[model samples]
Structure formats: structure tokens, C-alpha cells
Target: MQIKALALALLGAASMAGAQETASTAMPDDMPPPPMAAMLRPPRPDSARPPEPPRENIAAPSRAVALIAAEAALAQCARDAHEVGVAVSDAGGHLLLGMTMDGARPGRIYSGSRKNAAAVAFAMPTSAVQARLQQGDAAMAARVKPWMVVFPGAVPLMAGDRLVGAIGVSGATAQQDEVCAAAGAAAVKGRL
Candidate 1:
């Protein structure tokens, strides 16, 4: 039994060695490596690749501008006797500034952020998005991502024909929240 085991081990080793030798000899030394071969290959024709979407030079609001927007929204909510959270997001839906008023619910901050993201995604106010959803627009409803909020509390910040950022407010009635967000956008209108 010991002899048989030893013989099998030797046979396996011999087969592996033979396979390795065969593989090595299959490719010439002058041939480039796999990665280099890919690099050397010509690019696929334009028709073979999907057309890329047009690129736009969109700008994002600066930190100072974002802060101004958030402060303005918060102040508007306060003036309406509402303690709310404010969130300012860049065009790419990244938080640029965030603020929560005293006595506001902690979840209001998250709500504000989600509203901002939704506004940016739809390139319009969350109120419009909510209206569309209510009208049973299936196409628009399908575009609502999990991380987005279609509530009426966010407004996009546009600089001329370009979108720069968005502001969102939460903790008040939907209309009140949208009013606060519009105030925020107005505050930084010239700067954005």
C-alpha cells in the first residue's frame, strides 16, 4: 500500500510537470504578456461601443454658499415657528452643508438630506416630483431611488441654465418646508 501511494504521488507530479512544460512551450518568448497584448490591440469601432452621454460642465456650490443656503432655510423655518433641519447638497447629491434647529427631531436631518438628493436627481423641486407621483406617473415614480425623498421640501439651485446645488428643509408641513427651501435657494441665487 505504501508503494502504491508513493507511485501515485510521483505520477501526479510527473503529469503536472509535463503540463507546465507544454503550456510554457505553447507561447513564444517574443509574444507580449496577456496585459500587453490587450493594450496593443486596436480599440473597437465606435459602432461596437455604446455612445457616451454628452458631458456638461456643471459647477457645485462652494462651502460658504452652501452654508448660507442652509442658514437661510433654517431661519425661514424659525420665522414660521417651525424647528426644522436644513441640508444643502451639491449637484452630485453630496452633502455640502447640514444644520438642525434646536428641538427639531433628529430624523429631520436625514429627511432633509434625502429631500435634497431627490431634488437633485429630478432636477426640480421635490414638490413637483411629489405632484407627479400623486398623478400616478409610473415612469417618474420608478425613478425614485431608495435614498431619495419625493416630499415637498427641496428645491434645486440653478446658476443660469446650470444646476449648482439644492437645499432641503424638514420638520414643518410640506408646503412650509418647500417655502423654507425656496428661501434658502433665493439667498444664494446670485452666488450660485
Candidate 2:
């Protein structure tokens, strides 16, 4: 019995060794390495790019405009005796500026970011988002998404009919937050 067991163990060892060799050599033996030029080629020329239908140009708000809007929101919040946090984002939902008052709660910072995201996502005021959410369960279901704040604390920063960006305020009552955000949006209106 011992002799039979020893023979089985040896066979198993031989099988494992064969498996390791096969695994190690399988790829390199079956295929050549990729050419260096293929791996490190420059980007395709513009003409080589896939043809796409022409689309209207998009104009995102500048950093300077975002800063002006954020500052205006914070100033309005302060004037209303509301210590608040503010965030501004460009049309592409890129954060341009963020500010927080000395006494503002830490959560307000996150709330402000969410409000900004919500405004840019919907391309409208967050108050309108709130109204849409209240319209029906399906609207609320479709509207309540991750990282969204469907509340009254943000408004689009519009330059004429185009949505340039958005400004959001938090750390106050919903009405007060809306007031601050509106003030911020007003500051950047018609400035393009």
C-alpha cells in the first residue's frame, strides 16, 4: 500500500510540473510580441478619425465667471445672516469654485456640491427640480439619483438662452439657500 501511495504522489508531482511548464510557455510560444511602433504609435490623424455628424459648438463658462458667481452667493448668504457654503460648476459639470463661511457646517460643503450637480444635470433651478419630484412618484423615482439634490438651493447660470453653469448654496433654510443661489445666478446673468 505504501509503495502504491508513493507512486501516486510521484505521478501527481509530474502532472503539476507539466502544467506549470505549459502555462509559463503557452503565450510566448504561440504568439510573437507586439511591435513597438504598434504599442507606442502616435494618435491617429484628424482625417483618420471616424466621421461624426457635425454638432453645434458648446460654450462653457470661464473660471472667472464661476468665481464671481460663487462669491456673490456667499455674500448674499452672509447678508441674510446665513453662514453658508457655495459651489459653482461650468456647463460641463466641472467644478470651477467652492467656498465656505467660517461657521458653516461641514455637511454644507457636500450639500453645495450636490446642489450644483443637480442644477447642471437638469439645466434648471433646483426649486424646479423639487417641483418635478413632487409631481408624481414616477417623476420622483426618475429624479432621485445618486449625488443629486432635488431641493431649492441652486440655479442655472444662464447667458441668454444658453446655460453657462450653475451656482449652489447650502447651510441655511431651503428658502434662504434659494435666495442666495438666485443672487449668485443674477450676478453672472447676461455676462456670457
Candidate 3:
């Protein structure tokens, strides 16, 4: 009876050892034990990851388009009896074209350039920037005003979803300037 019991105990121990080996080998060596939530949740789709090889080049507005936009904005301001200054800047905030209506103040050129630079830097309409400032973004408002004007006189240019540059108008009321700047942005819409 003792020998029979010992044989059964040895067989049981061997089976337990074999089971442990099988369980360990069933999983990859590097895979961590899955979280409880992960086991219960569905697998994530592949689309969650961004596409490989991201876009390298950025599209920018051509010089001709900037000139045309500036001219158009200037003409629009003329119709309103406003002596406005218009400016266009590249994505890097470098001036591309600037124009002033015949009776516009000389100082308007400086304001227009500042507004354009602000629009490019912020990547939004200056009116939107003003709105954000008004809505209690004091830190941003303070940080940005030294280098660029934060009024409603400029807007970022977009070629589809891409930023191309910015257009700005000055020498008029903030609203009026915004209107002119918007016109300039519109003129170059389809042409990119």
C-alpha cells in the first residue's frame, strides 16, 4: 500500500510540472500579463495610429497671389471711403506685399505689418485673437502684444487646411479693417 501511494504521488508531481511548462510556453516570453480591462474590452482598430511617412512639405501662397490679395483689399477699403493699408506676409511672417490707399496715413503701414505678423503667428483671425483676449486669456494677450498687434484687422490665409500666410488691413476702425482683411483672404481662396 505504501509503494502504490508513492507511485501515485510521483505521477501527480510530474503532471503538475508538465502543466506549468505548457502554460509558460503558451504565451510569448516578452508579452506582459494583459490587464483585466484589456481582456474585457474590444481590440483597438488600426486607424487609431497615424499613417506612416508623414507629410514633409508645406504649401505657401505665391507672390502673385499676395499682390492680388493686397490690391483687392485696398480697393475694398477705397469703396468705404477709408484710407486703409493692406499687407500680406508669408508663413514665416515675412512681408511679401504691402499697399496703402492714396490717402492712408503713413503710420498705417506699420500697423498693417504688425497685424499680419500677429495673424501668421497665432494662426487665426486677429478678431478671434481679440475675442480670446476678451474671454480672459490675459497671459497670452500680454505675451503676444509686444511683437504684434492683436486687434481685429488680420486673418491667416489657408490653402485647404494648410496655413499659407496672413493678410492685414489698417487705417480704419477695427471692424472695417477686419472686413478688408477678410476680402483679401477671400480673393486668394481658390487659387491657394
What are the lDDT figures for the candidates, one per model? 0.83, 0.76, 0.79
Model 3, TM vs. native:
0.67
For candidate 2, lDDT tens digit of each residue in 1-192? 799667666666666666566564232123333333333447788999889868545456677877788788888988889999998876755566888999998877668767877888788888888887777658546755565777899898888778877888999998799999999888878676
**Poorly placed runs, candidate 1 (over 4 Å):** 1-58
TM-score of each: 0.69, 0.66, 0.67
Model 1 lDDT tens row, 1-192: 799667666666666666566563231122323333233458988889888778665568999998988898888888999999998887877777889999998888778878888898889999999999999999998877766888899999999988887899999998999999999999999998
lDDT of 3 by residue, 1-89 (tens): 79966766666666666656556433112234443433444776898756776634544579899888998888888888899888888
Least well predicted 10-residue stretch by lDDT in candidate 2: 25-34
161 in model 1: Cα distance from truth in Å? 1.5
- Which stretches of candidate 3 lie above 4 Å from their native place? 1-59, 142-145
Candidate that beats the other on TM-score, 2 or 3, i.e. the better one? 3
Candidate 2 positional error at 140, Å: 6.6
Query: How many clashes in candidate 2?
Result: 0
**RMSD of every prediction:** 16.1, 14.9, 22.1
